[model samples]
Target: MYQKSLVELAADLQKGAYSSEELTRACLQRIHTHDERLNSFVTVTETQALTAAQAADAAIKAGTAGPLTGIPFAHKDIFCTNGVKTSCGSRMLDNFIAPYDATVTQKLLAAGAVMVGKTNMDEFAMGSSNETSFYGPVRNPWDETTVPGGSSGGSAAAVAARLVPVSTGTDTGGSIRQPAALCGVTGLKPTYGRVSRYGMIAFASSLDQGGPFARSAEDAAVLLGAMAGFDARDSTSVDRPVDDYVAQLNQPLQGLKIGLPKEYFGAGLDTAVGDAIAVAIEEFRKLGATVTEITLPNTHLSVPAYYVVAPAECSSNLSRFDGVRFGHRAANAQDLQDLYTRSRGEGFGSEVKRRILVGTYALSAGYYDAYYLKAQQVRHLIRDDFLQAFAQVDVIMGPTAPSVAFKLGEKADDPVSMYLSDIYTISVNLAGLPAISIPAGFSNGLPIGLQVIGNYFAEARLLNIGHRYQQVSDWHTRSPQGFE
Candidate 1:
């Protein structure tokens, strides 16, 4: 039951092989039994999940159930869930219960998917590794001692452990793909504005986009179909028609033109991980696709540009948690100034504070043009690079991360080293294009991911290509030892 993909689970529910309630209970039981070791979930809504499962069963009986009906999934803690703690792995929101559902929550619920809980994540989506999470780091299920890649690490880890078949995650500079690679799950970051941002806690407004993590690309497509669409409530939500992601999963990849950015394969990529990606690309070639060496010349500037832009936006968005309206408040305050300073100081974890401070400095009057403005200008160059590449190729491919999951504390003290973990993925976000990371192979018993990038609003195409690759590969079906 735990190993079944979302599509299989849905088929089971439709055929009455098992009641939705039974399936939901099994998922909840698994979480209770195995999650302590993984520390993947921040909250478990057993009662709510059971109730939703009952409703889904009722819907199935009434012949109105959808594809996601009764499927148990988790939301990354960054999304606001009505009446549930919406902590973004930060002490600031530890006591905050959202008064409303995030757009993603509402859509999934309407589709009849059962929510088991909220998964843990990096503090306000700030770090590349899960160590910055205030709830504690999420250990990779593959090798317990290693770090699950961040921000979306908990979501990826949950799916990898089969705690849930699929989970919601937000990508801001590789949050979704990085962890998906490390945890050996399928993760997707849809084109910017493809999914609504309404009610999702803001990290970097422009860079943050919610996506999904699942065992396979097929499962991911099903969830993405339900999670995406125009939302007038979110100013950034594009009014473009949502693609039927699942409907395109079986599309053939023959004659597909794949671009391999020379820069990505050069320095920084780990040898084993790069080799795994090389094999994955050859498999694609065997499927009748042609691979070409393409160049995204400005790739080198992505990290520096992302650091400045993301932090700048985070500083502005996180300013609301200053203890005035809600969230954690300092118990004793000398005055308003003391209250604001002490509350934020105590509320945010170190990484969050570091980003906020850096963002504040970048946006400060004297440095605005020197830092933030320069980063934005560089962002355009990154976006243009992708546009230029797409003119000659159907998709671009690369190693999702520089290497496989490292020991939990390996790069915690070295922020720069940790940032490079996302060096291959940040460019996608900077370009506002769709991208996915699927398990390609493993190194030293840990997983590596192959990243596939596509042009704007090309999620369906990306998922299709991923689904085809998965048909000939079993990496996505592999599970962590104890968990299986």
Candidate 2:
């Protein structure tokens, strides 16, 4: 039951091959038996999940169930789930139970998808390695000592370990795709505004976009169909028609022009990972796709620009949590100012504080022009570079991360090294384009992901490209030895 893709699981449920209650119990039992070693979930909603499954079974019997009916999936902790602890992997909201559901949560519930639990993540979605999580790092199922990439590591790990068939994730500077790369699953980062942001904890509002993590591209397409749509409450969500992503998954890749960014193959990329990417490209060529080298001239500037822009927005968005309205508060405050200072200083983790300080300084009056403004200018140039490249290419292909999963503590102390892990992915967020990472091959027993990035609102096309690749390869089907 756990090995099936979401589409397969849905089919079985529709055919009455198994009950939703039985599948939900299987997942819960797996979590009980194995998640202690993985630390993947922050809260498992056993009673709630069982109740939802029962309702789904009734709906199916009544001849009124959706595609996602009774399919259990995990939600990233960043999204608010009414009555569940919506900890964004931080002490600041450890006790904060959201009173309302996030738009994503509401949509999935309406589709009759059962929520199993909330997955772990980097605190406030700040770090590349999952180590910044206040719940402690989520260990990769492939190798427990290594960090599953973050801040979506727990969701990625859960999908990879087959604890759940699919899960929700958000990509703000590679949060969704990076961890999926390290954890060896298919992860999609939809175009900015493709999914609503209402009730999702903001990281960098402009760069943040909610997406999905699944074992295969077909599963991702099914999940994204339910998650993508216009929502009036979120001012940034685009009022565009959602495509039938699942219907287009089997589209052939003939005549597809794939761009290989010259910058992506340069310094710092591991040879093993690069070789894996090359093998994946050859597989595409056999499928009748043409590969061409393209230059995204501003690719080198993405990391610095993202660090500046993301933090600036995070600093602004996180200001709402300073003990005034919601989130953590200090006991026995001397005054208002004292309350704000101690609440924030005590609630936020070290990495969150570091980013907050950096963002505050960048947005300060004197430094605003020199830092924030310059970063925005660079961001525009990066967007322009992608726009230019897309004119000749159907999609851009490259390595998702520079290498396979690194040791848990390797880059924890060095923020610069950690920031560079997302070098290939931040530009897509800066440009507000859709992108995906799929398992290409392995490097020293660890998986390497090949990224397929498309122009704005090209998620359906990207899904087709990934789905075609998965049809010819078995990497995405492979699971951790013991877990399998």
Candidate 3:
């Protein structure tokens, strides 16, 4: 049951092989039995999950079950779930209970999926490592000593650990894919605006997009279908028809043109990780994909550009958290200003503060044109590079992260190193393209990911190509030793 994918679980439910209650209970039992060491979940809604499961069972018996009916999963803490804590993995919102469900939450619930709980994440989705999380860093299920990539590390860890079949995640830069790469799970970051962001705690609104963490590309397609679609409530949400991602999973990859950016294989990428990606691409070749060497000349500037744009946006988005409103408030305030200062200072963790300060500085007077404006220009160049590459190829592929997961505190003190962890992923956010990180192979006992990037709104092709590659390779099937 734990090893089953969401699609497989859905089939079981449809076949009446097991009740939703049984599957939900099994997942809750697994969380209770093992979550202490992983620290993956911030809150587990056992009662609500059971109630939802019972309803799903009834729906199935009444012959009204959808593809996602009775599929149990967890939400990233950032998504607001009515009557449940949506902490965003920050002390500032630790006591916050959302009054309404996020669009993603509402959509998933409408499809009859059962929510297990909300998982831990980097504070306000700011850090590269899960270490910055208020709860605690999520340990990589593959190797407990190493960190799971953040800020979606907890979701990745939970899926990798078989605590959940698939879990919701948000990608700002590489939050979803980085952690998925490190934890050896299949993670997708949809094209910006492909999914509605309403009720999802803003973390650099322009860069953040919600997707899912799953054990396989097939499972990813199933979850992505249910999570995507337009909601008029979010101004950024595109009014495009959602693709039936699952129906296209078996599409052959013959004659598919794949671009391999020469810049990505340069100095920073780990040799073993690079070698693993090479082997994976070779498998894609066997699946009839034609790989070509290309240059994303502006790749070098992505990190610096992302630092400016993301922080500037984050600074603006987070301004609403002042003590006068909802969320944590300081008790010993001498005045309104004191309340705002102390509440924010005491509420947010170090990484969030660092980003907020950096963001504020970038958005400050005089520096705006020099920093933020120049970064936007660099962002345009990055997008142009992807556009040019796409002119010759259907999708671009590369190592998702420079290396595999590092030890928990290895780069904690060195913020630059931590930021560089997302070097490969941030560019996609800048370009607002859809990208996915699927398990390619392992390096030094840790997982390596081969990222598949597609043009805007090309999620179906991305998932299709990934699913085809997965058919020939079993990397996504490999589970952490103890968890299996």
lDDT of each: 0.94, 0.94, 0.93
Score candidate 2 by TM-score against the native.
Answer: 0.99
lDDT string, candidate 1, 1-484, tens digits: 9989999999999999999999999999999999999999999999999999999999999999999999999999999999999999999999999999999999999999999999999999988888999999999999999999998999999999999999999999999999999999999999999999999999999999999999999999999999999999999999999888888888888899999999999988899998999999999999999999999999999999999999999999999998999999999799999999999999999989989999999999899999999999999999999999999999999999999999989999998888888899998999899999999999999999999999999999999999999999999999998975
TM-score of each: 0.99, 0.99, 0.99
**Clashes by residue pair, model 2:** none
Q: Which order, best to worst by lDDT?
A: 2, 1, 3
Candidate 1: count of backbone clashes, pairs at least 3 residues apart or interchain: 0
| Candidate 2 lDDT tens digits, 265-378 | 999999999999999999999999999999999999999999999989989988988887888999999999999999999899999998889999999989999999999999
Error of 2 at 417 (Å): 0.3
Clashes of each: 0, 0, 0
Give me the runs in candidate 3 sitting further than 4 Å from their true place.
none
The TM-score of predicted model 1 comes to: 0.99
